[model samples]
Target chain A: MPKRACYAQDYTGLKILHTLYDSCLKAEIDFLDDHYLLNLIVDEGCIKGAIFLDSHTGEIIQINAKAVVLATGGYGGIYHGYTTNSYGSTGDGIAVVLRAGGAVSDLEFVQFHPTALKRSSILMSESARGEGGYLVNSEGERFIDELKPRDEVARAIFRQEQEGKEVFLDVRHLGEEKLMHLLPQEVALCKLHEHIDPAKALIPIKPVAHYSMGGIEVNSSLEVQGIQGCFAVGECANAKVHGANRLGGNSLLEITSLGRFAGDHAHQYTRSASNKEANSTQRDKDQKAIEAIYAQACTLNFYEKQQALGKLMYEKVGIQRENTQLLQAMEEVRAMQEMKEQMGIADKSPIHNQNLIEYLEFSSALLLAPMIISSALARNESRGAHYKIGFEKQDDKHFAKHHIIQWKREI
Target chain B: MTITILRSHNKQEEAYPLEDKERTLLKALTDIKATQDASLTFSAGCRASVCGTCAVRVNGKEQLACAYKVQDQDVIEPLQYHEVLRDLKVNKSLTKKTLQRSTAWLQTFQEASLTPKDEKFSEKQSDCILCDACYSACPVYAVNPDFLGPFALTRAYRYSSDKREADTKTLVDNVQSNGVWDCILCAECTLACPKGIDPKTDILMLRSLSIEQGYTDPTFVQQSFGFDPNAGF
Candidate 1:
C-alpha cells in the first residue's frame, strides 16, 4: 500500500501527452521530413534517399539524408477492442516497411494486458496491480493474485469471461483517500462515467487488445534486417529484447532509450552517406502514388467499411480466436479490400482533407488486420499474448520461432 | 418503490413512486418536475461525466449530475463561492479568462529537436480533457480564486517544461509576481484530477524550473534564509 502510494506520488512528477487523432499522423510526417538526418528510399533492390510527400500540398519534397529512423509506434489498433494503445495506432510503419521489401519478424505475436477497466475499453495500467489492487469475480471473491504477469492476468480474465462471471478490480481496501490520490483519473472515470466508485464499489473489468509483440525486425544497432539505411525504433520496431511479453513501465523506457539510439545512429549514418543526390525518377513515381492515394480517398465510403472491419475483427479475431474464425476474418478482410479498391476515387485536391487521411489510415488498417489474424492462426501456440483455443498449449518446438510475413509479389 | 426527495431551496420535502427499474438523479428530477413544478435547475451535457459540465453538490459532497445515481432521498445543491446563474450552473468564465490572461497557449520555442520518444515525456499532460474536476476539488481555488488554481498553473507548467518553447523566462516572471508561488502544495489538484493529471506536481515542477531561471519568490527565499526586516533594521 505504501509502495502504491509512493508510485502515485512519482507519477505526479512525470508529465505525459496521449495522442488521440491527427496528431499521431502529423508527428510521423514531421519526424520523417523535418527531424530525420537520413531518408532511406527502399525500392526494388536499391536503397537511396527517401522522397518526402507534402501531405498538405500533394507535392513530393525530395530530401537527401544519410539514414532514416522509424519511431512509428505499435500495432495495437489492429485489434478490434484494445485497452492499452491509442486508437490511431494501426501499424502504418509495418506496412510501409513491408512494401519497401524490409523483412518483418514475429508478426504473429501480440501482447494482451490483463485487467483493462472491466466492461469498458480503457486500460487499467499494470501499475494498478503493481500498486496492490486485487482482482475479484462477481461473488466478491479474490480470484487472481495481483502481482501475476500481464499474460497470466489476461488468460485468467479470459477464463472468467468464459465461465459467465463478471470480473472486477476490488480496490475498496485502498480506501477513498488513497484511491483519490493514486488513481484520480480512474476514480473519476468510474464515478462520473460509470457511476461506480473504486473506493466503495467493485470496478467492472475485462481484458482487451493491448500491445503488438510483432514488428519490423531490427538488431541492437537499430537497423532493420535486409534493408540498408533504414532503422526502426519504439513499438514500430521489434528489437526482440521484449521477446514475447513486455513488462510494465518498460514501454516508456523502451521508447526513450531506443528512440535516442535510432536518432543518433541515423545522424551518424546520414553524415557518412556518399550519395547525396535525390533520385528524380523515383521521386516522381512516389509523387504519383501519393496523388492517386489522395484522389482515391475522397470518393471512398470509408466509415462504413471501417465500422464493418471493426465489428468483424471484434467478433472473429478478438481476444480468443480459433482457426475457423481467423479464416472467416481473412475472407472478410479480402472482400472489404476489394470493395475499398472499387470505391476509390481520383480527387487530387488536398485542402486539410481529413477524409483523405482517414481513408489512407483505413487502407493501412485493412492490410494489417489480415496479417494479424493469419499470423494468429498460423502460430497455433499459447505463448505470450496470443492464445489459440484449438492448440491450447505452448508448442515451443514448432512455434518457438517468430512468424514472418511478406507481401505477395502480385499485390 | 416509493422515492422521497429533499428540496434544499425552501426546505420542502416530497415523495413519489418510482416505476423505472433504473432511476438516476436526472430521471428522478424529471419525474418530480412532471408531477409538480419543483424549481430545481441544473446544468447537464452528454449525461456522462466525461464533459465535466454538470458538477454539483449532492449530500454535502461535490458530484457530477451526469454521474451520481440518485437513491430514494438525496439532497442536491450548487457548487460553493461561484455565483450560480440558475440552479446549478456557475459562471466558469472567470476561470476561463484567468487561463487566457496567463497566455497558457504561448509556446516559447518555435521548434525543438523532438523525436517520437521526446513526445512521450509530456504526453500524459496533453491528455487533459479540461474537465475542471480538479478546479472544483482544489481547496486553494475555493479560498482564493486568483491563486491561478491547478488547471491554469498546470497549463503554464506544460508550456514552460517544453524544450521547444522559448519564452520560459516571461512565463516564470508572470507567475512570480502574483500568488502563484504561494500554493500550499496540498495536492488536492492531483487527487481531484480525473485524467490522472497531477497539476499539484506540475506546479511544484514549475516552481523549481522558475527558481532555476533566477525568478525566485522573494518572500520564500527571504523566509528560508531567515531574513527579518526588524532585525536588519
Candidate 2:
C-alpha cells in the first residue's frame, strides 16, 4: 500500500507543541506541572532563580538557577469571559515581572481575532477569508472586506454587533469537498460544538480576544531589559517583531527564531554561572497571603468577578477605545482589583487543586488589567492593534518609544 | 439540568447544578469547581480541544472536556492508566517516560529540502495533540505499562518516515524493546483519538519497517516442526 502524507494547514499550531513536548522528553527535560513561578528571585539587580508554589502538594520551592525564560505566553485569558486564549495564558510571567518591578512594553496593543466561534470563542483561521469566505452581518451583507487587517475587521464586527446585527462567516460557497479537504479541523469544531455544517450553514462568529502584542520588554538577545539573566520570548516578549499588529504565520516564525536566540543566550549565561541563592522574603510573604485565600469565606466568586472584568474590558477598552472610555476601563479594573480580595475559592485542597490555580491566575489578571489600561491611556495616538476612535492616526513623533511602568509599591 | 460527575479521588459521584449555558463538559465542570466545590481539580487548556490537556473519560469513553457536550447524566473521571493527581486530573509523567523510550524525536537534524509532499505524507499521524486519549484507552497498558503505547509509537513512525532523517536505526532500536509490535491492534486507540489518526496502521507500518531491517517480533519463532509441505492449496 502506498501512503501519501496529508498536509492540512495546522491553524492552531498546537500539534507542533506536541512535537516540541516530545522533543523535550527526548532531551530529558523535566516538566513540572501544578507548580507556578510565584516570584522571580532578584539578587544584585540580576535574576538569580525563582520561587514557585507546588499548588498540588502545597509546597513552596525556591530554586537557584543561572538563567530563566518567561515564555508563559500572553495575557489574553485576562479578558476572561470572551477570549480565544488557553486557560493558562493568564499573563503569569508579565504579572510576576510587574510585581518584581520589571519592564514591559506595549501592554495595550491586544489583537482581537475578527472571526471566532460565537459560543466558544474558538478562532476560525484567516485562511477561511483567504480562501474566499465572506463576513456577513444580520442583513446578509458583507459590510467590510473579509481580507482586511485584524483591527479593521474586528472593529467592523464590533460595530455590527453594537447595532444588534448578528455577524457570521459565510463560507457556504467554498463548497463542501474543498472545505473538508482544506479545513477539516474547523469543520469538525463547528460540527461538534455548534451543531452546524459549514457546507450548508453560516458559522456564527464574533471578535474574540486573541493575542497580546505587548509583553516583557526584551533586547535583541531576547533578554528582559534592566534585568540580568532573565529572558522573554514568544507573545510574552515585546520584540516589536510584529510592530503594532501581528500578521499571519509570523508568531510561529518569531517564537522559533527568537526562542532559539534566548535559549542560546541563557545557555551561555548558565555555562559559567555559579550557584548563588537570592532573597525570597517577598515571595514567602506572597505565598503566605495566597495560602490565606484557601481559608477565606465565600462571597463574590472569582468566576463572577472575572465575567464582570471581561464584560467591562470588552465594552470600554476593547475593539474601539478613546481616552474617556480607557479612563473608565481603568476605573473598572481598579474596582475589580479592590473586590478581588473578597472573591473566595471553594476547593482549598493542596492536592492538584485547579481552583487555587484559577484563583492565582485571576490574581494575575487583576494585576494585568490596569497595566494595559495605563499603557493605552498614556499613548494618545493609535497604531497597529491599539485603536482609539478619536486618535486614529499614528503619532510617531511623540509616542514612538515604549511605555514603561514600574510596579507601584502600593496598589 | 444537573450533571453527575464521578470524582476519581474521593470515589464519590456528585451532581452539580449547571449554570453556564455553553453546555460544554469543561464549563460544567468548571462551574462545579467555582460554585459547588473549590477543591475539584481538572486539567484544562485552550478550551477548544486544540490542547489535549482536558482529556477525560466521559461515559466510559475518551473525549476532550472542552470538545464534548455536557450530557444529561455523565460519569466523568480522570483518564485510565495514569496516576490520578486529583479529582479529574491525572499524572501524565508516564507519557513522557514512554515517549522517550520510543525515540519519538528526529534521529538526526540533517537539513532537507522538505516540500509540501513530505508534509502531506506524515500529516495524519502528526495531528496527535498528546492528550493521551489513546494512551488512556489502550488495553495493552493494563497488561504492561512498559509497552511504548500508541502516541509514542505513532510519533516514532512519523519521524522515521520523515524525508529529513538520515539515521532511522536509532529510532528503530529505541522501539525494538517494549514497543511497536507490542501493540495488540485493538483499534481502541483509533476510536479514542479525537483527531482520527489510526495508530494501529502506523504501528503496522513500523513493524514492516522493522522487518525490512531483518528484525522480526521478539515472539517470532521459526516453524521447524510440523511442516506439511503438500498441504497448500
Candidate 3:
C-alpha cells in the first residue's frame, strides 16, 4: 500500500480556493473605491449601458455609455445537454450579433468529453485519466490504452460498450487511503452516491457531452470575423488556439487572456468611435429584433418546447453520429423552429421569469444544433471529437481547414 | 461458503454457510436468517452507488454497501459523525442544513458588468454533487461540529466568486466567524470528494479574500505584528 502524502490531503479545500482567487472578484470587493458611481448592468451586451425595467411595474428605461464590449462567452450550450458550459450559457451573445447581420463562423465542431460520470451526468474531469487511471471491462481487463488522447479514449470506450462489455474506470490501484487523501470528493461520491469505494471497487464511467471545440470564429484580436463592434471570447468564441482538441487547462488560459485582450480592443474601438456616432436607424432595427425575440420566447409552452429541444439534440446529435441520425436531427430542429413561430407569446407582463430566458436559449440551441450536425456530416474525416464512423479515416487532404457554417438564406 | 462476522457490540463472532459465491450482502444475511433475526437493518438503492443512500462501515472503513465485495469474515457498522436513524442510515438533515447555511443559490446583482470570463470563472465548482464525503472526512467537523466545514465553505465560495453576485462583502462577513477561518487546511475533504471538488482550497481562498477585504483575524494580527495604531495602547 502506498503511504498517503499530506500534500494530497489538503487538495479539495485548496483547489476550491484557487478558483475563487481571481482578479475580477478581488477587484470588485477591494479595488472599487466608488460604489455609488458604479452602475452594474445586466444584459447590456458588454457595454456600460443600463436597460432598466421597473421594480414593481413593467417599464423600460435605457442608458448610454462611452464603451461597449462583447464579453459574451461561447456557444457550447447551444448543443443541449452535451456541453461543458453551465446551464446559463445559451449562445445569447452569438445569436444577437448574428441577427445584426454579423457574420458567424465555425458553428460546428463541438467537443464531447470522453468520460463523464455514468449515472449522475457529472463531468469526470479528463485529469483523472491523464493522471494514470485505467479504463477496464467487466472481465477486469484493461480494455483501452490509458495514454491515448481524449477523442481516441472516447471512441474506444464507445466501441467497447457497443460490443456489450460494461466498462468502468479502475482507480483501485490508487487504494482507499490515497484515494481518500487525493480525490476525497470522488471517493466519497463513490461511497455515498454511486455506492462504490473507488479505492477497492471499479467506478462505472461513460462518455458525455462536454466542451465545444468550435464557436463563433474570431481572429487573433478576438474580433468576430467580418462583424464590426462585435467580439466573443472564452469557450463561446474560438480563437484557433484549440486546433482540433483543446488541451486541459487551456480553457482558463483562453478565457482570462482572450477576455482581457477583447476588452482592451473593444475599449480602443469605443474610443475611436467617440467622434462618429452609431447608425441610429441600424440601432432601432436591432432593438426591434430584440423585442421580437423576447415576445416569441415568453410562450406558455416555451419551457416544454425547450425540454423537447434538449431531448432532440441529446438523442440524435450526441456522441457517435451517422448521416441518418444527423438528417433526422435536422428535421426535428425544423419542426421545433415552426412550433416557436406558432406559439406566438405568453407573459407579456415583463416579469423576471427564467422560463422565457430558457426558451430563448433553446431557440439558439435549435439553430446551432443543425449547423453542428450538418458540419459533422460534411467533414467525412475523423479528427478530434467530430468522429464519423461512416467515413473513418482522418483525410487531412480535403478536411484540413476549419469548417465555417454561415446562416445562408436557404437551409 | 460459510462466512463469519464479528459483532462490535457483544464481541461475538457468528458463522453461517452461504449457497452462492456471488451472493449479495442482503442475500447473505437472508441465508443466515435462522441465527439472527431476518429483520436486520441496512440501506440500499440502485445496488450500484448512484443514489448515495447505502453507505456503511465495513471492516473498519467507510464503504458503500452496494459496491463493497463482502468476504468470509468481515465486520460491518454504521457511519460516524452522524446520528444513526437505525442501523446504517445517518441523518442527512445536517448536510442539508450546511447547504442552506451556505446559500448555494445564484446571487445576482442589481447591476454589474459581467463578461464571459467573469461568468466562466467559477463554473467548475458549481457542479457540486452534494455527497457529504468531504464533511465525513473533515477533521474539523469531527472535532468541532460548528466548523462551517468544507462543503459549506466551497458553496459559499461558489456564490462569492460569481462576478454577477453584487454582495461579496456580506458573504465574507457571514463566514468570518463560526470556524470558517479556523480550518487547519488538512485536505481530507479533497481526498473524500467524489466530484474532485476541493472544499479545503475554497475555505483557504475565502480566508485570503476575506483578509484582503479587511476582515482579519485580529488576535493573530496583533500577535504577529503587535499593532497598536488603532487602539493607541
Scored against the true structure, residue A187 in model 1 reaches a CA lDDT of 74
Q: Alpha carbon lDDT of residue A198, candidate 2?
A: 94
Cα lDDT tens digits for candidate 2, A162-200: 899999998999999889877888999898778899999
Estimate, for each residue in B97-143, the C-alpha lDDT of model 3 and write its tens digit. Answer: 66545554445465668675664466446545454556777777667
> Against the true structure, what is each candidate's TM-score?
0.64, 0.94, 0.59
lDDT at B31 for candidate 2? Answer: 75
Arrange candidates by lDDT, descending. 2, 1, 3
The value of fnat for model 3 is 0.00
TM-score of 1: 0.64
Interface CA RMSD, all predictions: 15.1, 1.7, 17.0
What are the per-residue Cα lDDT tens digits for candidate 3 across A13-67? 2333333433234343342111111121222233334233331222344445544
True contacts kept of each: 0.02, 0.88, 0.00
Residue pairs whose backbone atoms clash in candidate 2: A5-B120, A5-B121, A6-B120, A346-B38, A347-B38, A347-B39
TM-score of chain B of 3: 0.71
lDDT of 1 at B192: 59
lDDT of 3 at A154: 79
For model 2, the DockQ equals 0.67
Identify the candidate with maximal TM-score. 2
